[model samples]
Target: MIERDHPTLSVGRQCRLLSLSRSSFYYRPAGETELNLDLMRLIDEQLLETPFYGVRQMARHLRNEGHAVNDKRVRRLMRRMGLMPIYQKPNTSKPAKGHKRYPYLLRGLRVERPNQVWCADITYLPMRRGFLYLVAIMDWHTRKVLAWRLSNTMEAEFCVEALTEAIQRFGLPEIMNTDSQKMVVSSRVV
Candidate 1:
């Protein structure tokens, strides 16, 4: 890998030596400037420490610590960082406009055996250079990962692939549980 080569070799030189075009070494630049990356890193660490901090509060905290950051910039950075306020939702989770949604029939129901209930979740994994979306389906009774898949794009195809694999291997469940996240739920249904 180019990243594994001698530290003294410039990336352009390495590309030439490997008979690769500099353009082919395509990597998206860090989303922020080096200075901004430092700020974002600090903000992320601080947010993890105190998730309740809003943009205003975070800006105040940073200013108190001598980081001359404003609330606007902090808010933008937090948004880019995927930080958001957490709150409970009272209404039923929203679904796609045309997709049919089934009522929660398994509420208060007991699941005691394999294939009784399956739960799936999709989460975002942030990396230094990019991000990935991960989806996993687990048997509620056994607490085992029946299938999982990762993708750089948050599309429905990967979710379908995971579900299809699980079905091919373990068979379908009595009921599949998942949040109303559009990509996940939609893929499973259609």
Candidate 2:
């Protein structure tokens, strides 16, 4: 540690003892350039309108608006501003080839009874160390979670197990519904 106000050691002697260059010690960090600041302000406003635009698209948009910006530069400024594009991230819900999609039965149907309509959905659960997948079977009318299961893996077995428990506890519903994504995602038989 260099003590500039120390009565004993001179500033030059302190620098020598610390093995530090004078220029480096005197150097203060200067923030982003003026052009970068203006660009970032424009980017901030445009980001609110279209949050799905990624680095390349954002750069192209800026270039189209007569701003000389590259993807790398746009990416850097966006990163510095802590901004990320909102888009569909790849997940484990991709359907298999030639899978038959079923029509939604409860679209206009009035679910008057508890067991009249049932639905199941799957989502991710945030954990301290990592994440766990959760599948819940709910009664449409009661809005109750009849059965649920948590699994570290996204296998169909856990989802099926939850559904089986719900069906065992209560009689079969008139209509069975789940997210369309769960068609080929969870189980083909469910």
Candidate 3:
């Protein structure tokens, strides 16, 4: 720490001793402007409603709300604020290392009824700081979300809870399908 008001050592002397530039020693960073602060607050609110909104969408949203904003401006603000939109990643269909491949039983069979086949997926809900894991049970044919649960950690409780809720409400399906990773985690706990 450079003490500016040192009785013996001058600010210049202290900076030289520390090998610091004189300008850097006296530099004071300018924080966000008032307009930028207001815009950031609005962006944060919109992010809460839709975590998947990218720079383009956020810029459009701000423009629609009567704010003179562009994608470039929104992109810079979001990058500075450490905000990122969650989207699908590539190669998600590929299985992990040492994971066994299962036969696609539904390939030849047709799923017409709602309860004929059910599927569950474990996805994470993005947040500002961290994210929460979500387990959703859906009817395969109807594409309706029967039940969903959120948890801080990826464990079997939330998955089992969602499955339980779905079964209780819509009854059991003839077949239940989920990711292999999910089955492993759930089997370990359940």
lDDT of 1 by residue, 1-190 (tens): 6874676998888899999998879866756788789889989888888776778878998999899899999999999889974433233234557976657857688989998888888887755345678999999899999999998877789998998999889886878887863222332443
Off by over 4 Å in 2: 1-80, 83-90, 181-190
All candidates' TM-scores? 0.47, 0.49, 0.48
lDDT per residue for candidate 2 within 1-190, as digits (tens), equals: 7777999988888887889887777889999999999999989989999988788889999999999999999999999999998764437678778977876655577779888778888888755345688999998799999999999887889998998898789867767787763222132234
Ranked by TM-score from best down, the candidates are 2, 3, 1
Clashes of each: 0, 0, 0
Against the true structure, whose TM-score is highest?
A: 2
Off by over 4 Å in 1: 1-95, 181-190
Tens digits of lDDT, candidate 3, 1-190: 9987899999999999999999998899999999999999999999999998999889999999999998998999999999998765432355657976655656577988988878888877766456778789999899999999988776678888998888889877877778763222122222
In model 3, state the lDDT of residue 139.
Answer: 90
Query: How far is 10's C-alpha from truth in model 1 (Å)?
Result: 73
Looking at model 1, residue 77 earns an lDDT score of: 94
lDDT of 1 at 176: 83
